[model samples]
Target: MLRGVKREVCLSNLTLQHPRPYLFVTAQCDHRIFYGCWRVFWATYHVIWVLLSWVLEPWVLYSSSERVKWFIYLTNWTYLLLAVQAVTEAVNFFCVHSLREDIVADQQAVPMPWYLKLQWLLYNIVTTGSFMVTAWYWAVLYKSDTEIGAVRVSFHAVNSVYVLLNLFVTATPTRLLHFIYPVLFGVAYTLFSALYQLGGGTNIRGEPYIYRVTDWSRPWKTLLMSSLSNFLAIPFMHLLVFLLRLMVGRLWECWRGSGGSEEGETRRGRGRGVTCVDLGQRMTESSSIQAELLVSCE
Candidate 1:
C-alpha cells in the first residue's frame, strides 16, 4: 500500500475505480511558502538565463537592433506558464488546507470557472510540450542558428527539462483530448513566424527566418515538407507527456495501494489500502463533479 500522508501532506478524494482521483500533498499547506518557493525558482532561472544571454549574445534581449519579440516569445512563454502554475498551485494548496481542517469540507462545493480549469490543463500540456519541442528542434534541425554553444545548448537542452521534471512530480492525470491546446499553441507560433517573415521581420542576426528552417528564402517545396514534418512533431510531444503522466500516476497508485487489490477486489477487509466501491457510480461522479479538480494534487 502507498504510505499515508506525513504531517505536511494530506491525501483527499481517494477512490478506487476506472478513473481514480487522489490528491498529491504539497510541500506545505500554506500559500506563502508555496508562492515563495516558486518565486525563488523563477528568480534563479531568470538570472541564469539573463547571464547566459549576456555571455552568449546580447541580441536576444529587447535592447538589440532586432525586432522586439513578444513577451510570449521563446522561453518567456514557459516562464509565464510556470508563473501561472505557481499562482494556481498556491491557491489550491491553501484550499487543500481548508479541506483538511474541515473548514470547507462540509461547505457546499463551489465549482471553479471552466476557463480556470482549462488554464491548468493547458499549463501542463503547452509548457512541457513546447519546451520539449524547442530543445529537440534545436538539437536536431536548428543548424542555421549559431552552433549551439554552451549558453544556447543549456537553454535548449537542460533548461527546458526544469518544467518537464516539475510537472512530472506535481501534475495529476488529465484527459488525453486536452492535448489539442498544445498543438494549437505550436501552430499559432508557426503562423506568427510566417507572418513575421512576410513582413521582413528578422532575428538578432538579422536573418529572415525565426529559427532557420522556416526561412522565407527556402524553396516552397522544402519549406512545405519541413513545416509539415514539424507540425506533426507537436502531437508526438503531447503524447510523450500523456504517457509520462500515465506511468507516474499508475506507479503512485500501486505504491500506495490506492487501487483495488492485486486480485482486483477491494481491500477493505484487510484494513490496508484499497476499498472497493461501485465502479459504475464512481465513473458517473468523476465524469460530472469530481473531474472539476478543485485543487492541485500537490
Candidate 2:
C-alpha cells in the first residue's frame, strides 16, 4: 500500500510540471537542429575566409612592410583556425547524433556522450584562438608605434575582464556576450580607423585639423545629416582611445615628477625619452602576454 502511494505521488509530481518538460523538450529539439545547420555555416565561412585572403593578397603586397606582413599572417591564421574549427564541429555533431541513437536503443543503461567532450574542446579552441589573433593585431599596432592611449587600454582591459567573467559565471550565459561582441568589435574598429586617418598628419601648432561642413545653406539637409553622423561617430569612437592616452600621460607624470619641483621638470623631459622606449617594449610584451593569456584562458 505504501509503495502504491509513493508511485502515485511520483506520477502526480511529474504531471504537475508538464509545461516545463514540454518547453525543455522543445528547446532540446531546436538546439539539435541549430547544431546541424551550424556545421554548414562553419564550412561556408571557412571557404569565404580563404577566398578573401586570395582576393586581398595584391592589396596586402602594396601596403607598408609592417602592414603587409601583419595582414598576411592574420589571413593565414584566421583561415587555418576556422577550417580546423569547422572540422571539429562536424565531428562533434555526428558524435552527438550517434550517441542520441545509442541512448534511445538502450534506455536502461545510458553511457556518457562523446559529443559533450568534443563540444567543450571546440569551444576552448575557438575562444582562445580568436582572442590570441586579436591580441596579435594589437601587438602589431603597438610595435608600429600606434600610440594607443590609456582610454584604449582601459577599454581593452574592461572588455577582457567582461568576457572572462562571462566565461566564469554560468548564471549569465556567455551567449549573451557572444551576441553583443560583434557590434562592439565593429564600432571599435570603425573608430580606430577614423582616428588613425585623421591623426595621421599634423599642422604648425601640432593640433589635429578638425574637419567640419560649415555651410548652413538649404537643400543640404541629407548631406548635413550624413556629415553630422560621421562627425559624431568619429569622436565617439576615438573618445575611448583618447581617454587611454590621458591615463598614460597622468601615469607618466606621477612616475617622473612629484608636484612642483625643478627636478620634476628635468625628470619629465627624461621621462619622455624613457616613455618612447617603454612603449616599444610594452608593445612587444603585450604580444607575448596575449599569446600566454589565450592559452591560459583556454
Candidate 3:
C-alpha cells in the first residue's frame, strides 16, 4: 500500500498533475529566504525586463536595416513568448496569493485552468527555444564586424539567462515527455521559413533567405538544418532541463533536511544523506502537503 503511494508520488513529477496548486504560484526558495519577498521581486523583475525590451525593439529595428522584418526572427518570437509567460506567471502568483487563506484552510485542490496550462506549455517552449537561439546565433550567424548592441544581446544572450534563472527559482515541474512542445514550435518555424521563401519574402537586405543557413535556394542544406534543430537540438535541451530539475530538487531536500530540528531528524532515522525511499518516507512523515508536492523519485 505504501509502495503504491510512493509510486503515485513519483509519477506525479513527470505528469502535469501537480495536486498542490499553490506550488505553481510560489518560488522554490521563498519559504527559506526573505519570507516571500523573493517571489515578488523576481516576478516584478521579469515583467519590467520584458516590457523594456518590447519598447526598445521597435526603436532598435527602425534604426537598423531589418525594419519590419524584425518580427520574423526566431529571437523575437521567443522573446514574445517569454513576455507572455512572465505576465501569466505574475497573474497566477497574485491570484493564488489573494486566495491563500481560503486555500490553506480548506486544503481543497484547485483545478489547474487552461490558461495556466498554456502558460506551462509556453514555459517549455520559451526555455528551450531561448537557449537554441543564443547558441545558434553566436555559433553560426555572428559576424566579427557586426555591431553588438544592447537590444541584440538581450534577445540573444540575456534571454537564455532569464530562462535559466527561472528554471532554478520557480517551483514549476518539468516533464521529459512534454518536450514535444519545443519540437512542435521548431517544426512550425521551419514550415514558416519554407512558406516565406515560396511567398517571395526576403530579409533586411532583400536577400532570398532570412539566414544564410536557412536559404531555401539550397533545398538539401535547409532540410538538414531544420531536421537537426527540430529533432536533435530541441530534445537535447529539454532533457538537460529535466535532469537539472531533478538535481536541484535533490540539493534542496538535502539543504532542508540539514536544518531540520534534531527531533525531526531522529524521527526520520537519518541525517543529511538519504536514499530515495528514505527521503520519500521522511517527507511523507513530516508533512502530508509536502509529500504530495515534493516527491520526485525515479
Candidate 4:
C-alpha cells in the first residue's frame, strides 16, 4: 500500500452492478500489456538514434576524451537504461501476465518485490536525466543540420521528445521535494566537468569546457550567469514536468470517470447519478498504473 492511500476501498456497485467489473485483475493485465508495448516501442525507436550516434564516430567509444563529452556519455547512459527497461516490460507482458490471471477482484493487493522497487527508482533517475538532455540541448545548443546526415541532427537530438513521451506514459504524481533528484544529477555533471578540466582534458573541438554555454574562458559575468541559469533550469524543468503530470494525469482520471459514469448510468437506468468519487474507485488497483491507463474490461 502507498503512504497516504486507503487500504480498502468500497466499490461494491462498480464490481457487482457494473457489467464490466471495475476491478484490478482485468485492469492491471490490460494496463501492463499496453504500457509494455509503449515502453518497447519507445526504447526501440531511441536505439536507432543511439546507433546513428555511434556510426558518426565509432572511434569515440575507445577515445576517452571524445566519449567523455556530456552529450555522448549521457545519451549512451540513457539508451542503456531505456533498453533494459524495455526488456523488463517484455517480461511483464510475456511471463507475468499469464501467471497473474488467477488474481480476482477481491485479491487486488499484490506484493511487490524489492527488485521491482529498484527498477522504479532507476526509472525516475534515468527519466530525469533524459529530459534534462533534451531541455538543455534545445535551449542552449540547437544548430541546423541541413547538409550533413550526421548523428547530431538526424537522430540523436530528439532526447527532448523522447523524455516527454516517457513522462506521458508514466505520469504518477510525484512529491515536489523529490525535485532534488534532478538537482543532484546537475551536481554530478558539474563534478565531471571539474574532473575533466583537472585531468587536462579538452572537448571534441579542443575547448576547455564540454559546452560553450558553460565555458570558463568566457567573460566572468557571462559564465556565471549562464552556469547559474543552467543549474536553476533543472528545478524549473522538473516543476514543468510535475505540472504536466498533474494536468495530464487529471485528464486521464476524468476520462476514466466520464467513461465509467456513462456506462454505469446506461446500466442503472437513465436517471441514475454516478458520483466522481464512485468513478475514482473504479480506477483503484495496482500502483504501477494508478489513474493512467486503467481501461474498462469490456
| Candidate 3 lDDT for residue 190 | 90
State in Å the error of residue 147, model 3: 1.3
lDDT of 4 by residue, 175-195 (tens): 333456656756666666556
Give the residue spans of candidate 3 off by over 4 A.
1-16, 32-66, 100-108, 260-298
Highest lDDT model number: 3
lDDT of 4: 0.48
List the global CA lDDT of all models.
0.47, 0.34, 0.67, 0.48
- TM for every model, in the order presented, reads 0.61, 0.31, 0.76, 0.63
Candidate 1 lDDT, 1-298, residue by residue in tens: 1111111122332211112112322321113366447635654564566455655655445563443453424454554454455456555545555554432232223333343354456455545554665655666566684566665555566555655665445534444444556666656666676777788887665677666666766658546844564466655665566555544543433343443324442211111332233222322111211132322345
Cα-based RMSD of the predictions, in order?
A: 9.6, 26.7, 5.6, 9.2
Per-residue lDDT of candidate 2, residues 195-256 (tens digit): 53355632222333212221122226534543443344333333332233223433443344
**Residue-level lDDT for 54 in candidate 2:** 43
Which candidate, 1 or 4, would have the higher lDDT against the true structure? 4
User: Candidate 3 has what TM-score?
Assistant: 0.76
> Across residues 1-298, which tens digit of lDDT does each residue of candidate 3 receive?
2332343444445445554555566565544234245545655665666566657645455545456676677777787787777777776666666756543232435666565577788888888888889999999999999888777887788888878877777767676666788999999989888888889998767898777888999999899999999999898988787667655655555555565434344221234454444444433422322333444576
Candidate 3 overall Cα lDDT vs. reference? 0.67
- Clash count, candidate 2: 6
Candidates ranked, most accurate by lDDT first: 3, 4, 1, 2
